[model samples]
Target: MEQAQMPGCYRHPGVETGVRCTRCERPICHACMVDAAVGFQCPECVRDGSGTGHSRTANQPRTIAGGRITAGHPHLVTQVLIGLNLLIFLLGRLNPALIDETVLIGFAFDPDLGRVVGVADGEWYRLVTSMFLHQEVWHIAGNMLLLWLLGGTLEEELGRVRYLTLYLLSGLAGSAFTYLIAAENQGSLGASGAIYGLLGATVVLVRRLNRDMRPIMALVVINLVITFAWDGIAWEAHIGGLIAGVILAYAMVNGPRERRALLQGAACALVLGLTLATVVLRTAALT
Candidate 1:
């Protein structure tokens, strides 16, 4: 007796799969399988309906990452993020202490709070909170405006879940990078890191779609110049977020149709793990 090799997906030739599309009997990987009334169907069968009098499958409308296509305010996640940032900023204004407590720092002695506080001191929440903190109107304004412009399209294109994951992980990666290299007492807070991540993601998306690339490329170059030229800007966060976003967006958009979700999830996990490791190493160095 001889063993037969598993067949690959019709659309993705690289994924080894044992399942076949019920409609056309073509092999399909999980990424390309669309649920049907009878059984799973391939994307082509799901799209055309093949004059079989079958209604369009409920699972037909999917994003580039296989996320469900949301109707009516597809950018809901983006809207919520902006709203939350604004609300936090307002709170910080009302209670200036909130800014002191939340701003990103590896380690710092807070004279007002009369205590040593920082990520190394176990206030790790700062990594996330700092992304939403802004003392200056100009800082928040610039960030929110960029988020509105870039986030809406990216959210719609990548769908809510992937877009949110990319945003958060990018922000965390930025915070981790800042903690790893920036002076322990150095204070940094802003959404610029996350926005830069979106900027990098936009570049990847534009490239994937084969659209004109000059505008996005120019935007990135200009921001890089600003990141380095400016005195207070955290260049570490910007570079870290940009790199994480590029890696994640590439995985999200171009993961092979065979086990694509698994691959993308692994990429996300890799970023998170590396970021966590970096933070831990820095914490040890500080202590």
Candidate 2:
């Protein structure tokens, strides 16, 4: 059998690479890559910047994090994510059995199904599904409210792609941390981790834009206080998501010129790797 042909850099046809110009969609090796307005661009594409909707040139609109500016609906991703979570919550309400199958649990037996079910049982998707599922009205209400308030700002500043990345990764980090710390039979669910991630990112952004810090600072303190003081709160998930968000946001906001994409990508990979590692370790311990 022959191996599949690798994509060669457009500029240097002999050089193989998987990276592509975000604008023209041509393969580009690291040396031929240029971080354009939103992401990497090939030299040819960058030369045509004024003609296209992308580029570092002033003709194009961009966010603080260099994502394409969608002026008409800056909060589009935020709205969709909020709506999806609400939809899932409603579905769970309509079919209560769905909640048991999807809730984040380290490891547990389902007597109704007469089988083991959980992350440790290889149902890893629960980490993602649980974040969008809430049983009680108050639980969903609180999470959706915070997401609406905080996510719009993030989606506006970071653009849709980056904002969504931060949200989902934050939630997964929270689930992984909770899995490691909570009892094997214990089930925890919420969007708290993702919410706290956005909250932490807001602080970094406020500082970046030189906005007044008092209002947001007060809010962070209050949430942290609640995370600790409130009963049934999965404080571990909150802390994990907060830490991941701060690191990821710093990369998205402060990533240096000439290598923003590379650094930001690295940061995202690091957070994801850490989350996966935590899950693997915890699962091993449980089994």
Candidate 3:
């Protein structure tokens, strides 16, 4: 009787092998084999079986972690933003005299002053810095609470760079709108506008995922009511930030999966460019 020829490994045809992939039952050499829960599997089987037990959807945003955001991981960007706001607020409290002449003058969004003093006069920084300033205890507390709630989710989904970009651009949007609508010499300060942007982003993100929007809508509506009902609130800023957030989020959600980073960056640049143009035109009109 002649001896039978043994089957060779699928990946290495030249080598004969008795070992087989547990998942695909194909002959596999040690080099092509991957460890599985129950037994060994081929590379192709291992690749196909990844995340087979999880419940993630196709529409869900991908992150650096290769998994959904969990409570175990800390939202570092959100925490840093909150800390910066608190630190500024504390500094303002420590030196009460700095509120007007120093802090607000140097950082708060003052369209009238910006128009007159101009960027050469150091008012340009206010567009970015104003988002970190808070005067009253309630103001800082409320903004921080909202930032914690919304920022964590947005940061987790969008990642740090995108989250920070959305925030700063949102602030600039708010300031631009305030400059266009606010009375001359009126100074505004707070992270409320950026926080509102986060809310709008949340709405767009939820809608993209085909999830319920009522809860998020309710939050927005309530905030809008408060914005209009309260005295001295910059409803213009809130509205501007919300609109920017919606547009930015839409761009992000609709972007191609393979070119997401490029698309997102382009969207942010468009928004920033439009905002800058508006400011320039408004300032020219004032001049």
Candidate 4:
């Protein structure tokens, strides 16, 4: 009698193989083989045995909408903001003249000029530009550190566009508050207002997630104390930013899920409108 040749792998008909699946006794190619404790098995056998106690299946992590969560990474927007701030600071250092002529007079929030000379006279941009300006090394260092910490978390949760919007709005709110209350001829410039806004946003987001808010609350209290204790600190800006952040976060989190985007946009627009109105009223009072 003639000896029979070993059958070819089912997955690869052209090639001949001696390998046999332990479970199904089917010939398997290297590509189709699944390693088992006892022996190699064919893909079909492995799939068939997947329901057994020894078999395991991996589950993808999901979010609110049954969508799978993507891999986590550092927040880009936060990093970019930090870089821009540092670059501006370095440039100001190189040209001290820039601080007086460009940063302070033209960009830093000057309540007296903003109210008296008006925005068209080069005071309007200060509300926004002030956020990226810092007078001292320690000032930028502290603000940047806080921003790196809190901003990353906010950006991850709220996404780039929303986080950026919140940050600028909060900063503007801080400037507006300062304009309304600060002494005439007093000028403010720093990222402190925006950093405070991040802290407030973190608190609101934590509350929304039903997580403990004690640690964050403690931080807020401590920072507020520091703000008051230190001379030349813009406590008003801190308070204003915090209030604006809380309101904005609350509006975003509590809005209807079906129309969340729309609601958030409306809420932000409303806050901005109120800020503009406050500026108008304050300027009018001065005039």
Best by lDDT: 1
Stretches of model 4 off by over 4 angstroms after superposition: 1-73, 102-120
Range of the 10 consecutive residues with the lowest summed lDDT in candidate 4: 60-69
TM-score of each: 0.82, 0.79, 0.71, 0.70
Model 3: pairs clashing at backbone N, Cα or C within 3 Å: none
* Clash total of candidate 3: 0
TM-score of 2: 0.79
Better of 1 and 3 by lDDT: 1
Using TM-score as the yardstick, the better of models 2 and 3 is 2
Please write out the lDDT profile of model 1 over residues 1-287, one tens digit for every residue.
89998886775555678888777899987766777776677766766665244527437646667776665787899999999999999999999999899999989899988999999999989999999999999989989998999999899768899999999999999999999989999999999889989999999888866567899999899989999998899999999999999999988888676676988899899999999999889999898
Candidate with top TM-score is 1
Model 4 shows how many backbone clashes? Answer: 0
Question: Which digits, one per residue and each the tens of the lDDT, describe model 3 over residues 130-201?
Answer: 778888989889888988988887776566777888888887888777776775456777887788889899
**Lowest-lDDT window of 10 residues in candidate 3?**
57-66
Clashing pairs in 4: none
Give model 4 RMSD, 1 decimal.
15.8
Clashing pairs in 1: none
Candidate 4 lDDT, 1-287, residue by residue in tens:
99898776675454467888776688865434555666676655554555233323423322221122234453878999999999989988887645544332212344533443333244677677778888798999999999998997677557667788889888888878887777545667887777888888889877765567799899899999999999988887898888888877766655555676677878789879988987777766655
Following a full C-alpha superposition, what root-mean-square deviation does model 3 have from the true structure?
Answer: 12.6
Give Cα-based local distance difference scores for all models. 0.86, 0.83, 0.70, 0.71
Q: After superposition, how far is residue 244 of candidate 3 from its true place, in Å?
A: 1.0
What does the lDDT come to for candidate 2? 0.83
